[model samples]
Target: MKKATMTKMHPRCNEHGHTVPIKQPSKASLAQAWADPQGIATAVPDSAMPETINDVPVSAWQGAPTDAAGWEALVAGLSFTEPPVPSAPGKKPAAGVVTIEPDGRVWVVAPTNAFGGYRHTFPKGKLDGLSPRASAIKEAFEESGLQVELTGYLCDSVRSTSVTRYYTARRIGGSPAAMGWESQVVMLVPISELRGITSHPNDAPILKALPAKAIVIYEWGLASGHRVLDTLAGHFTRYGEWPTRIAIPTGMHEGLREEILSPYGWRLLTERLKVVATDAGALCAYGARGQEHSYDTNGPVDLRKRASEWIWNVDLT
Candidate 1:
């Protein structure tokens, strides 16, 4: 049998019998050394390593000291601070809530000291020992001073190091004046406008997912009212754009026509209207013909009739 050529590995110690691996500069030590001009002396030169090993320098290693105290001092001089940010092992789970009110307004609070310049967001906090739903409700009350009932689940997300569960809630009682120290002020904003005020972009989608319903004032006898409403619903179904509030004359007349046509292009002169008319005669003519035409049953005619006998509310919101 042919004798095999054996490659000899270098021993842990150098020719001077000094420990080699023990003196290697840690990442923190290397960073500190780079900051100090004298650290260039301690850094291993690229030429120190053999030409075979990817031409990479054995940068971290250094010659060990002779005296025991000197070795201890060199080891002490090394640092380990440059590791990744440490997270607490086995951190507890957390929960938060998105609270809404009965009037299509959502509850949000401004923290006393906001993060990333975010002043307005839905109430959220760490979960204690309670269930996620219970914790969410508790957080809502504690942060906004409102007692809320958990309606349904909103979403769950990993925020920072904690996995937080979110729930949808509705205010039942209490007032913003009773808010605890955690929040500066509690605000109730219309759901449509919630995204504009909230500083956190992540919270905007939750507010957007809520149903969009408008309170439109329309007289049952007016064919123009039905025409406008049916067209609006069709537009929403096709494009997913909806109006949160709509206003129409309780009964059309010369005054109403003048108001609608007042430099606003008859108000319905926009793309939403099938036909644009400036005067009452033209508007009434459209309405008279509108009654004879067939419309989609899926469109909200019955819903509109059910909500009919409408009162004139001064405030559309």
Candidate 2:
């Protein structure tokens, strides 16, 4: 067939004495190879593979590495590694608690080695490997000499889940003589007088997170019919970005089955969601205006809602 002649690859992909079919080149194909830095045309000098200017080698696209390790290595060689931080930081070993009494009073424990003067403020303490509540109980007993039960979710503060549950525990047992390392004295005061008390740097965080919830709940009830029996989360409106919430009802969202979610700016929000499990199965329902939503750290509870999309997360157990 007076076909067009061709030049050899010089070194075939096979190590020795082997020849594969000679492939023809196309104009559109040639444009792509010329655009690639790793393509055969770029590797060969002008003296060789003159025809490669016309097409990508079949090998160029074939038998690509089955794994990413090779690509990762190539990227590593071309990229710079950021130097590590010179100073390694330490993480706090455990969590602490602040228990206030029912008469709006908290027994502040004084630190044993006060940096400058005698220090005293609510019964606060740290948790070991045991449950947080259990540790709080032990510390309160040891520090303030009082045994009690934890009642409510006071607030969540800090970046690393330093969630301290403030309990309104009745003094079930013990006395004021008990003490621990860095802890010596304990006394009580009304919640209305919380801010007036002297505080340590760490104490400030707990106080800030302390919920003025009694008032917020009262306001929610006055404004809307939804009487907030408890607050599951807090909302602030300092900036102008009003948060939009979409109620996610648990079922299963089938593999991003629709493109509509993005256009609507759908986001999974933790603030207003409630997880409800029942005889039927586990379901996720979010707070609706008609339905009450609370994020009390006591955790979200599914009360009820209307006209909200109820989808399921199949991975949910």
Candidate 3:
């Protein structure tokens, strides 16, 4: 029963029934375990893929899988992609919102009602069951009232009856005084003008559940605003992204110079890593979106002079 009470074990029974024990879960559970999606689309195993992304025609990889474990299981199933392909058989879970402004235009929405006063759409909806990733974040703040923050996941189409999901939120907080009532005809289109708007011919189920190219990766068990010393319980790793350290930022390093980046799963393959930041800014995440950072390290020391305070390396094959 040592090791600092062993992070807290669990197994209970009590009342003389002989088994008592409980009290440790201070927090951190999130919980999720209920997938079925028609047995993951028939678990297609036949491989020989390469159907696109620079010469993949030949009628587009018929039964994909030519070798290397069926092309690394068709590139790890397109780099771990799944969910949203159920547009027909009993569909429901909906929610949309690509919203990417700052002069980038990616807020395509569809679905209107009124004609002269309210007839626009695309800040979609229809998810309350709880998790189409939390209903694409409550249907993008209930159809563009604002209040967004997801920063990831922009797929899930499901074809026919309606499976939507398309998220990539950003706004940050409710605005336009907080919209609702189906967003009174929301607008905001750009991803290349969204083909002249008024879409929804079923918008090709969010452009065939988008994903032709996008990839980025890098992460390390983080959370050290400054006085870090959790005893390296997680001992996070992946440290080599783009080396050549500290030419700046000192003390609690003004807050881990954030610039999160996630492309993981499409951009084919890329790497240019080199990290070393502490004093609270020592993280240079990538894929799961944590882009580039340098926590100006000043403690956990040891890595050489700059104590690894800065110096990452990644050649990405």
Best by TM-score: 1
Instruction: Give model 1's TM-score versus the native structure.
Output: 0.41
Residue-wise C-alpha lDDT for candidate 2, range 90-139, written one tens digit per residue: 53333344654322344566554342353555554444454444555555
lDDT of each: 0.44, 0.34, 0.36
Give the worst 10-residue stretch by lDDT in candidate 2.
308-317
Question: What's the candidate order when arranged by decreasing lDDT?
Answer: 1, 3, 2
Decoy 2 TM-score against native: 0.36
Full candidate order by TM-score, most accurate first = 1, 2, 3
At residue 275, what lDDT does model 2 achieve?
25
* Candidate 1 wrong stretches, greater than 4 Å: 1-92, 115-117, 211-288, 292-317
In the predicted model 1, the residue pairs found to clash are none
Best by lDDT: 1
lDDT of 2 at 41: 18
Q: What's the true lDDT of residue 257 in model 2?
A: 14
Model 1, residue 170: displacement in angstroms?
A: 2.0
Model with the higher TM-score, candidate 2 or 3: 2
Candidate 3, residue 231: CA error in Å?
A: 9.3
Candidate 3 lDDT, tens digit per residue, 258-304?
Answer: 32123222111122232334444244233223432333332232222
lDDT of 1: 0.44
- My TM-score estimates for the predictions, one after another, are 0.41, 0.36, 0.23
